[model samples]
Target: MTLDDPTRRRAHRAVVVAFLAHGVVSGSWFVRIPDLRDLAGLSDGGLGLVLAALGIGAVVSMPLAGALATRHGSAPAMRWLLPPLLAVLALAAQASAPLTLALGSLAFGAALGAHDIAINAHGVAVEHERGRPVLSGMHAAFSIGTLLGAGVGALAMAADVAPRVHLLAIAAVTALALLAYRHLLPAAVDRHRTAVRAVPPTLGERLAPLRRRWLLACAIAAMASFIAENAVGEWSGVLLRDHRDASPALAAIGFLAFSLAMTVGRLTGDRMVAALGDRRTLLLGGALAGTAWALVALVDDAGVAIAAWVVAGLALANAVPIVFRAAGARRPVGPDGRPAPVPAQALAAVSGLGYAGGLLGPSLIGAVAELLDLPTAMLIPALLAASIALLARSATGGERLPSTAARSRPAANASPTPTA
Candidate 1:
């Protein structure tokens, strides 16, 4: 489809809506973790284990979701997975026992993992159709949704609203969003299958790309980025309240600042990529994120620490998306003249490993905090962000930037090799 096609435009809007709903749902859960911990009567270590269960679920489900998307197209897979995800979200919110909550979290995480891959795959497809950068903008919508969700969650906390009520409201909104955008998603037939029409690969072939050097590098970058991002989302509020003596209402401000900065960064990310290219953006962003974390580790003032969180958010906003775009850009022709599972498999592998880092983050931090202190524990993500800065070349992939003229033209008419 051409960039000017009205259908393509509608699809773009649909994807943005989907992303927004995703962000709201995610933010609603994340912002309420402190409350949940209290409700379940769990220690920090216990809560960390619950969070780790969620990550494990996501890791288990992501590859299967990717395979499904590769076969049946992203839109259908997303449509099928979303309602169950919403249900699990509500279920998780209602759990009173630690075991029940952990089980609910596992289910919730599985749904989120599958839904994430499908939605991202759809976004990549839309980007290909439009022939310009849209993933960052779509992610911006997610950030905005999260910002709104977190803001509203904070208000609810201040008003003494119950977690069940708050989560149920989010579920209702998510359901409405799905119904509104159901028809706008691209049809399964509209998706571009691999160039060759051979039978699908066996499981071994589907996973072959995991051994490639470039794909492994991309996975590591994704892991480090997630470690940093998830650390802020999961711990920022606790740090503010426990370490900085902020009130519950005020504690939410830390994540709020981070999400707001992320939204701004993503909204402008396309232009930045256009000017500086992916490598430089990753390097610069990683440096900024690393510095922010370092400042947070050293700074004693709560307000200054919040500012550091915002700076970190702005810097790391585009890191994972850049890696994803690079993964999507790779399209290897197989010996049978069919398309290999390079992009889809690479996305799943990287996302699974990356999510593992996110899963480990809370527990790791809690353990470190028990031994040392929260500020000292913050140093781990700081070091990881610095590692990302040093590893920025992984995103470059030795590819030339697409010419402006080429980018503006219809991608359908372009060569088969994908563009990042």
Candidate 2:
């Protein structure tokens, strides 16, 4: 109920650490992409294929990860999945050929996807048990971790450290963090156990939430948000450099501004959600992101475009978190009156679609840019953001939890009568 509760405190800390670890490993890998490309002597198309392996792997594993979490609980699933992922990261760092990189990317992506679902499941469960909004702050930790990892990687690059050495260091640190926080994770409980033991539902029944209109809408909204976010991450620098003729150093500023805005927005997201409610937050965020993109599309000034990117990041910061929280909270109840397939399964479905959109968005933008122009191609995410705003209500399922103090207060009219 409160941080004074040890279990709650520990769970919260563990979840944050888990998120940080995921981000650190991912950021470290991302920063070394150019080096990896050079090492493999891959052309742009070859590199694209190698990166695609990662997405393919992630898409395939997301549902399976959800199933594992549902059966064994998030803690055990995370504990079991993280080591392999770390190993894969190390393997990827050592990759010397296109084929090896692609294979490593596939394994790395699978591990990352599974770890993501498990950690998010843990975060949602912790939030529910604590009975207050926390998912946003947890996501903020992830953003911070990413920035930290990227900073570290940049420093390593400046020092001319080998990719293998850098990646090994990241793996070691991540492993240490995992070991340190392992005890704090929520203990695994077999959801199958009951006073009267029940058989697990069939796969069809477990996945029934996928057919629900509300869930489908949430997934679509998540996809739209992801498309916007990934577009900025992947193409903002190019847009500035190629279109605006900004210097290389100046061009990098766009992504930096975007990342900082995202981190700041998420850090303060809980208060906003408490004040505005999920529906309002989603509406405002989507509108803000759409408007920012429109500004970027309409304006030609580099500085103005960078500022727009920052606004876009801030606006889009909480979109995915809101979608995930709603999915976990509103999972369908089974025939036995228990949540079917579990929250993780619903999260996985949403995340899978989002990941697909994220991976496809930049490539789609590139194709459209070739067909039309970069500015016009950029309008696609703006439109997507507007769609998210229009559909915010349906996406969030209208679920709103009261503030902590409100939830903790006893009803005034329900005071207990004096007992003899």
Model 1 residue runs over 4 Å out of place are: 1-4, 183-185, 188-207, 330-342, 398-405, 408-420
Report the lDDT tens digits of candidate 1 across residue range 36-114.
Answer: 8888998777877888888888877887887777666778887888898899888899988899889988998899888
- List the candidate 2 regions with Cα displacement exceeding 4 Å: 1-4, 34-48, 189-207, 237-248, 330-341, 369-376, 399-420
By summed lDDT, the worst window of 10 consecutive residues in model 1 runs over 397-406
lDDT tens readout by residue for model 2, 1-420: 123467767778888888888878876776666578779997544655666687778877877777777667788888888898888898789999989988988888789888888888888777766667888888888777767776677678768889999999899888976764565545442222221114544556444666766667778888898778766655665577679888655655666677678889999998888888888888999899999999888898998888988898889888888878877762234323444344666777778777766655656776777677787888989989878888787765565532222444222112111100
Which clashing pairs does model 1 show?
none
Q: Give the per-residue Cα lDDT of candidate 1 at 332.
A: 47
Output the lDDT of residue 376, model 2. Answer: 80
Deviation (Å) of 82 in candidate 1: 1.0
RMSD of 2: 5.9
In angstroms, give how far residue 195 of model 1 lies from its true place.
10
Estimate the overall C-alpha local distance difference test score of candidate 2: 0.73
